[model samples]
Target: MSETSALSATGATESRLVGVTAALATVCIWAGWLIATRYAMTSSFTAVDIGLMRFVVPFVLLAPIWIRKGIWPKGLSVTNGILMIVGSGAFYTLMVASALEFVPASHVGILLPGVMAVWAVLIAMLLFGERPGKVRIVGYAAVVVGVASLVALKPAGVISDDMLMGYGLVSAGAFMWACYTHAMRQSGLGALEAASFVGFWSFVVMAIIALFTGTTIGDAPMGDIMMLLTAQGLLAGCVAVITYGLAVRHIGSTGASAFGAMTPALTALGGVILLGEPGNLALVLAVVLVILGVMTASGVFRRARI
Candidate 1:
């Protein structure tokens, strides 16, 4: 190859490598967030309190950057930004916190990311007229089967009405995230811009809700509060958002999203090690199936084969 062509090829390869690294880092942060949130729920902190903290710290730290960048989205971008805030911001956090109360971290790992992958593909098909090839079809089927197995094979006394409600809420949160991602792609906003916008508006909305609902961050242990503030706010809220954006920009959304398959198993393992949550045969099987399905549906494996 010509020197210029070789240089271009090298640049493309490096960019994709960076994207993959970012995607993997994002997954680890998300898994850590799940574990931290579960731990916080054991303290005096309510889900709303945790959600409030998620926005508060990030907004405080990122506000100046947002202003300096002059990053106000307009028109449909504005609408999409609002959707992103509601879908993946405070509302999503609250849903996750509440769900964690009823279910274990393992369940959250499986349900949230698993449902999200399924929804992302389904929404793309329905709204964007994207046709799934044969491999993708098999992948989708595996996702469905894995999710179903999770529900059906949950430990005894874990499938009560309240737990089912929690599952539904978590599923809703996943769907909202999928919507936020779609809007973000459509809005053409940079990752930092979108993250800052969502953080600012999420703080505003959560502040209003806290005022009306009398939701206060009760006097929890200082360590727990600090952990929540740092993990949810800085790591998952700011870092993961930006990195995931970079992943999408460099590697395409489908390829970046394929990394989500690893999240469930990682979260489940984290829960077992950190939270003392039980890991069973069913959870293992579900994780394997879901990861395989996501890899296939997102065309990661197919692309690698090519």
Candidate 2:
């Protein structure tokens, strides 16, 4: 290869390396956050309380920067700001947290990302005129089927019927999150700016709610409060969003999201090993279908072939 070509190849390799590393980090944080959210839900804290802890610290920490940058991001549209609130802000937090009381984190890991990926493609088609290839459509179909089977089928008694509500809520949350992903992609904002946008607006929504309904923060145990503060507030709320934004920077939004196909495996294992949650062949198969489908829908193999 010519010297210039070699230099170009080296730059591409480094960029991919950085993107992959960031994507991997985002996946780990997402999995841990699922596990931690599940643990909190099973304990004394309500989902609302979890939401409070999740955004409180992030809001406070990012406040100084956001105050200077102003409330709305410089170039972000009003529509995207609204969609983002539904996606990563108050609505997103409450939906996922509420589901955790009934849904296993393993199921969450598999289902939410799968559904979100499908929604992303659908939204892209509707809003941007983007079309998925046949293979990608097939992958989307697999994700839908996997989600259905996971929710409706329970031959081995792996999933509880009571969890149906949880599954429904998660599917809805995935749609909202997909909207958030697209908004983030179009916003032309950096990682920190995106984090601040979601954090500030979401905090406004939640603060309004707390005023009317009151808060459970004072009633919860200090240890649990502190634990969730670190888990939901710092790591999941601020750090994960920022890190995933970095992945978006390096790899493009679509590629960064494909890394979410890894989430089910991580959270499923984390649930089984760390939390002693039950797992069986049925759950395993469902997770496989979801992962494989998302990978294909993401054009991961197609791009690799090129």
What TM-score do all the candidates reach, one by one?
A: 0.89, 0.89
Best by lDDT: 2
What are the per-model numbers of colliding residue pairs? 0, 0
Q: CA lDDT, every prediction?
A: 0.83, 0.85
How does candidate 1 score on lDDT? 0.83
Clash-forming residue pairs, model 2: none
Task: List candidate 2 stretches off by more than 4 Å.
Answer: 1-17, 151-153, 156-161, 249-255
Residue by residue across 159-235, what tens digits does model 2's lDDT show? 66668889888889999999998987778876677777778888878888888878878988899888899988898
Candidate 1 lDDT over 1-306, as tens digits, reads 999999999999999999999999999999999999988876588887888888887787788867875546554466677678878888888888988887788888888877887898889999899888899889889988887777655566357887788889889999999998798888877777777878888888888888877664666777777888889899987989778888888988778878867899999999999999877788888888888988888788878887
Cα error of candidate 1 at position 22, Å: 3.0
